[model samples]
Target: MSLDPINLAAFLGMALVTYLTRIAGLALVGRLDLSPRAQAAFDAIPPAVLIAVIAPSALATGWPERVAALVCGLAAMRLPLLGVVAVGVATVVALRMVA
Candidate 1:
């Protein structure tokens, strides 16, 4: 029994799905007029996705890391968004390396 090939296949499947989704979305969106409700939902998706991804990762860490991530997220809301991500990732990496 082996897991490496299964992991690789799983990763490739996800990558393929992600690529197809993006390509299909781009191909379809411009040609169709989305309903007003759908457009509103689409507008909401970016922030929803950002919060969904960041909230869990930021909250799942230890107290110190969570505090750091919270502060970084607040600071990120003020700076270019990438700064916040950089701060969070760098802090975690540094903590991991030193510990």
Candidate 2:
């Protein structure tokens, strides 16, 4: 296997752009005087994005994964992000064992 210089440079360029966007977003948001309603919507973005990424795969996979997703969703209501992820992974493994 060979390391292609073009691919490596492309990957690094994309990573820099992504990083800059996030930093710029933070800088821009820091100066905004957002109302409570807008702030609430902004705070919800991370979890919404997390669900958007994970929900499709979870719903389309086997029963164990679906069940785990449900359990994870429930846990998310009360737990932090790390805890929620742990619960999801553990639930899937346990359910798979029983299946």
Candidate 3:
């Protein structure tokens, strides 16, 4: 099987963009003199971005997925992180199988 040149180039371009953006962000942040509140906000960016990315799919799907997310959130309150994740995954798989 031969690799297509266009696809190869596009993949490389995406990699380059991702690499540069990450480096640029690190460098910019390193140089900044952020206040305590600003630093806290910056730390929250990752989880906030994660929710932004996942919320759409979690809400758009069927009831099973929504219920799984809710169960996972509740599990997170009492279980270890890995245990919560396991419960969430197990709940979703069980719900999907039943459906």
TM-score of each: 0.54, 0.86, 0.70
lDDT of 1 by residue, 1-99 (tens): 667988999999999999999999999999989899999898778757887877787688666577667777677678665676677777777776666
TM-score-based ranking? 2, 3, 1
Candidate 1: segments with Cα more than 4 A from true spot: 1-16, 32-44, 93-99
Compose the digit string of candidate 2's lDDT tens values, residues 1-99. Answer: 999999999999999999999999999998999999999999899989999999999999899999999999899899998899999999999999999
List ranges where model 3 is wrong by over 4 Å.
Answer: 75-87, 97-99
Candidate 3 lDDT over 38-63, as tens digits, reads 99898777656755776688799998
Worst 10 residues of 2 by lDDT: 42-51
What RMSD value applies to candidate 1? 4.6
Q: What lDDT does the true structure give each of the candidates?
A: 0.78, 0.94, 0.86
Which one wins on TM-score? 2
Residue pairs in collision within model 1: none
Global Cα lDDT for candidate 1:
0.78
TM-score of 1: 0.54
lDDT of 3: 0.86
